[model samples]
Target: MTGWLDVHAHYLTDRYTQACTAAGHHHPDGMPALPAWNPQDALAFMDAAGIAASVLSVSSPGVHFGDDSLGADRAARDLARHVNDFGADLVTSHRSRFGLAASLPLPDIQGALRELDHAYGDLRADAIALKTNYHGRYLSDPAFSPVLTALDAHAAVVTLHPTSPPGWQRTALDRPRPMIEFLFDTTRCVIDLALSGTLARYPRVRWIVPHAGAVLPTLAHRVAFVCDLTGTPADLPTALGNLHYDLAGTPLPVALETLLKLAPPNRLLYGSDYPFTPAPAALQLATALRQSPHLQDATLDLTPDSPGATLFPRLFAQQGRPEDRASPA
Candidate 1:
């Protein structure tokens, strides 16, 4: 009933639908218009579930398509603004109950930089959301350094969500993408970043990898060995330590153990990947977290000082209740 924050979610807008159609991409099964996916619906769900805040973000398959870098960049940038403005309006209406994560045009450094400036200066987004891989190239690639560089300059808090690689959807496996591929994508991204020294280069950037860091925790020993073989022992712990993991869509025992072994307690935050994954699941996970014997004495309580205290402690105190705030973040 308290310390609840749903940080991962998707809302479809006209700009996003149009971009999908323009790029010859078929809209997914659940894709719909803005009104159909409004924050009001999320608020209603949160209220019913006893959630205090929900940090919303545009969903995956973010703008990049097969070699359509320029077109994807333009679409992504425009859609980022549209989403941010819409989120700003929602925050104005709902205040602390809702915040936004900005979408970026990845693999296109300049476009990403421009979007970052606009999203921060104008839209006042709480953080940024990025897919693990854009079209097959992982963000850990050196080619994407400029994107990280721009994010570091802005001191952005980024949440890494995952989507299947292009052409892999509806495969013969007959499995929901989230059940199998999303976790793999997240783990792969973490490994790529570790191998590429991304964590070292952009040390200050705060990242939250969803699904409790996917498979990274379970496979850390092997990953560490690989790093050692490659003569980068320092990167193993650095990557494991520097990143945050969101407790969205991951089982409690798995998430709790992963947090315990791979990251600090404070780096483990609450997140419910809503809509696609229901809010009740998060409640169940939180209950399990509270009951975990593996957790230390420090992490037993996840509640904020006030309803909105965890994410925006100072702002909530200064501005009074969350509904009274003017800015989106």
Candidate 2:
């Protein structure tokens, strides 16, 4: 694990920033202004952190930046394409060091489907990054079933990122949404999928749950009990075990222990939530992960050559493009 394969790094393009700024989405989900990001700065941080490769996706406040149905949907679609194209170019320039998890303009199934085709068929994205909720609609809603079906057809790897829940954004108790709301929203999305039978319906879609499964691990048994009482056939523990959890911002000992109880070592992946997390903080978490006593013999696959590679074969397989082994920055 000399060089990490970060599954949770973010890439912010200039076009994306402009879109957010113009839409007055500066404090998205109640977080402060968007963190600055540039290829050189990201590459420099990766070098210092010993990250050989990173799978990039857009951060919070995704593409849909406003409430206008017609206008915002169109803007979101365009922004999604721009972000994907920008990420694809980064992967092209640094084939071995960069991979893309294409963003989708959710709450708009047709537009998302179009982007999905372009991302996989045209740009060759490694995975799809989906927000927990879209305009107050959770991913498990029937409206998103079409997109889930399409993803299932491709057997796509989908990464779940948290966004402010519809009505809770303004009521975060004056604290940053990521501090508490993000974790709660992640749990909400997972529970919705489980209760609504979405997870059981689409088993092929490999889900990557960030922030160590984000409070879901702690509530797995309770959810299972409730499901049993309600006669829902969803198996909470098994559903969680089927998915991957990244050790990103929440890399504490308790978080690791709880997540491991649900997902095995093979299902664990490395993540550095860079830019959102400063370089020093990201490095601190990485060091803590390496030194964890529970993970002493866990075979944490942070590098490209690990069981984690099987999680996204289209991107990690050594068959297509020539590997770009050049120094980053």
lDDT of each: 0.67, 0.84
lDDT digits (tens) for residues 1-329 of candidate 1? 34355666566667666776676655442234222465667777776655666778876766554365566567666766676677667767766577778887776777778888877898777788888888878888788888888788877778888877545655516555666778787888888787777877887677888887788878877878876788877547556866767777764645667556777666666666776565566557656665677644333222544223444442343333537545444
- Per-residue error for 199 in candidate 2, Å, reads 1.0
Model 1 poorest ten-residue lDDT run: 27-36
In angstroms, the error of model 1 at 37 is 2.1
TM-scores, all models, native as reference: 0.82, 0.92
Top candidate on TM-score is 2
Q: Model 2 over residues 189-263: C-alpha lDDT tens digits?
A: 988887788988998899999999999988998989887888875578887887888889876868989888888
Q: Name the regions of candidate 1 deviating beyond 4 angstroms.
A: 14-36, 166-174, 279-322, 325-329
Itemize residue pairs with steric clashes in candidate 1.
Answer: none
lDDT of 1: 0.67
lDDT for position 46 in model 2: 85
